[model samples]
Target: MLKIDSIKFDDEKMDNDRLNNYIKKSEDAVEIFVDLLKMDGQEEVVGMIALDNDHRLIGVLELMRGGDTFQKIGTDDLFYLALRLDADSIILAQSKADGLKVSKEDYQFNEFLIEEADKFRINIHDNLIISGRDYISIS
Candidate 1:
């Protein structure tokens, strides 16, 4: 099982850069395993999320092309996956609010159900999802 501590953050707490930093720092490589999804009653590549090496979800990643690949490079790959699921906007907003400052790039994550809330740009609702994911707290 990969403990949260084991998975250290490179930038601020929830900065999207953590993903990139994790790949470079962790001695144990990151492995991606996406489930085959189905519209109703057909076998597909988009299904439940899982983990590798004893099966413990340290964090989340993108699901692309029926099978999960060892994500080594590119934000586009994750963006593509979000695009596939239609949750890009939320991801982009959250990633931005959480990602690093000095480093910036093309806005990503335009998939998933989108909505608005008080300054806290969140995708999931019913409660503040980014309670701890905030890297910079604007006061």
Candidate 2:
């Protein structure tokens, strides 16, 4: 059996904020990632923004952290997290410190995710490349 721990945003060691809106668009997903996942714009960080069927926030998980090159995401852990969260969909994000442009590897990974997510019956909303304070949706 696998047990997952829950962390409250208001926990003493962590800051908290109230989000009153559902993630209706790519920009909404970008806002959540930028505010919560502070990428230094120096390393490659890949994460998933899990959303419920109503498009409301469920949770965010940093799936993999890599240096300045592409890193393969672990589908086992990724799918497990999504299933545990009961996520209806997820938005994939990666940090490209050099620029906000999507790389060929990015597209390939996105394509691979789409196929994997389909098998899991989870939707892939978008694939975003985040660089510094800017982001572009590659999906």
Candidate 3:
């Protein structure tokens, strides 16, 4: 089983009740995503929010971190972790220096994730690109 500490969100506690209440919509998920990134102090991070069948929070995964320009997300590791966690759906979020802009690669990756999720029997809820205090949903 994966422990919450495995994802290490700085010192902020992962309040299960609050997170569950705040994750019902994409807007709420974006807020949580921004908060998590701010807490982690990462300029560029690719992360995933995993949810169970009923959309309850399972856990969050910090997939990869890189330079402000770009971060590569490993599909194999991502899907393997999702399967291990038994996630029914996932929301992808990435922080970029380019504010609220979804790059071509981001679109391609989101499309690919949707296609791959079908095979994995997992739902791709949304893909968000966040910068500073703003975000744009691409998928």
Candidate 4:
């Protein structure tokens, strides 16, 4: 059996006030993700923003964490949470502890995510790579 863990959000640990201000823009998405992840000298982490039909914040999911080089996220694993939350759209994000440049792997991953998202009737609004004090949107 391929067991998927139950997704949970630690409300107390998240900056809900800052997150609520995000309005689906790439910049706002980056701000919210940076605040949530606080990727200061830390390893790479993958996260997702779940949104309702109106683009309101549903919640955030921290999907995977890996060393400096890479982090892996599976479409099936991500969509499981989206389905559970009944989300209409999702914004994907990953911390690039190295810098703000988008790697070939990043491009391929976002491409795969977009194709996979369509099958579930979910819109992938954007994919952001956050670095020190900057970000790049590969939507």
Candidate 5:
């Protein structure tokens, strides 16, 4: 049998200034991708930005990483994290090393996310496709 004890750390409240400043628009999301993701690589990646009810960012999660062309996002896993983080809404983003167009699959996935989020009462703010220095909002 394995027993696990809870670990604790000092709590500190931080201002939401940085997140509020950076995530104002779809283009800002592209800037976040450029800074956070290793876009020079050949692999495709899917990530989410969790936000509170006020649209202030809570955190960013990288959900899936796959080959240059394909990455599948698990809706259950995505929302599970959101609930764990106590997020009220989320922005979905994917990287395409080849181009900046939102694929049909991406659109379908966003629709699926919207449907599932409704069931959970979570908001799906936007879906973005990022490639190099550019991005497209498919919301």
Candidate 6:
């Protein structure tokens, strides 16, 4: 069984406030989702970017159709390799695509994510997009 797959925001150590400090309500950030596939035993992630109105970047979630769910991987897993620009809020959801729904409280970052899950699409960053990852400083 996969031991970790939560989405509550406070569950893990948030990088720091700087991640989202520059984000403006007047402008919305673009959220990107990456799906890495290993078809011939070689690794390659197929990434999709999600955008909000006003076009600032918001989320940068990763996906895999088989094997590991995003939550099963440690926080640094993707960061060490393929990282999105960065964000005030980066999250992992054990998507229903896998036939799972983690309890709200038991899930980390659940509220922010689930609330935005619907009414969004995968898109790319153009000049108008503001990346949260770009402004945040790590402690």
Position 46, candidate 4: lDDT:
77
TM-score of every candidate? 0.21, 0.79, 0.78, 0.78, 0.76, 0.28
Which runs of model 5 end up more than 4 angstroms from their true locations?
1-22, 68-71
Ranking by lDDT: 2, 4, 3, 5, 6, 1
lDDT of 4: 0.71
**CA error at residue 97 for candidate 3, angstroms:** 1.5
Q: What does candidate 2's lDDT look like per residue over 1-139, in tens digits?
A: 1122343333222222334336667766666666666664677887788878877667887776777434565776787788898989988788866777766877887788888898999998877888876788877
* Candidate 4 stretches greater than 4 Å from native: 1-17, 68-71
Between candidates 4 and 5, the one scoring higher on lDDT is 4
- By TM-score rank, best first, the candidates go 2, 4, 3, 5, 6, 1
Over the stretch 106-125, how does candidate 5's per-residue lDDT look in tens digits?
78877877999998888988
Task: Give candidate 3 regions above 4 Å deviation.
Answer: 1-18, 39-42, 68-71
Candidate 6, residues 7-78, lDDT tens digits: the string is 233433334532232233222222221121112212322222222443333444434543433345443443
- Give per-residue CA lDDT, model 4, range 74-122, as digits (tens): 5887898888887799888778657677778878878878899889889
Superposition-based RMSD of candidate 6 using all C-alpha atoms, in angstroms: 15.9
- What would you estimate as the lDDT of candidate 5? 0.67
- How many clashes (backbone atoms < 3 Å, residues ≥3 apart in a chain or on different chains) does model 6 have? 22
Q: Where does the lowest 10-residue lDDT sum fall in candidate 2?
A: 9-18
Better of 5 and 6 by TM-score: 5
Among all windows of 10 consecutive residues in model 4, the one with the lowest summed lDDT is: 1-10
By TM-score, the best candidate is 2
Could you give candidate 3's per-residue lDDT for residues 29-82 as a string of tens digits?
776666664513346777788887877667777776777433445676788888
Clashing pairs in 2: none
RMSD of each: 15.4, 5.4, 5.4, 6.1, 6.4, 15.9
User: Model 6: residues >4 Å from true position, as ranges?
Assistant: 1-55, 58-61, 68-71, 78-84, 98-100, 103-139
lDDT, residue 95, candidate 1: 18
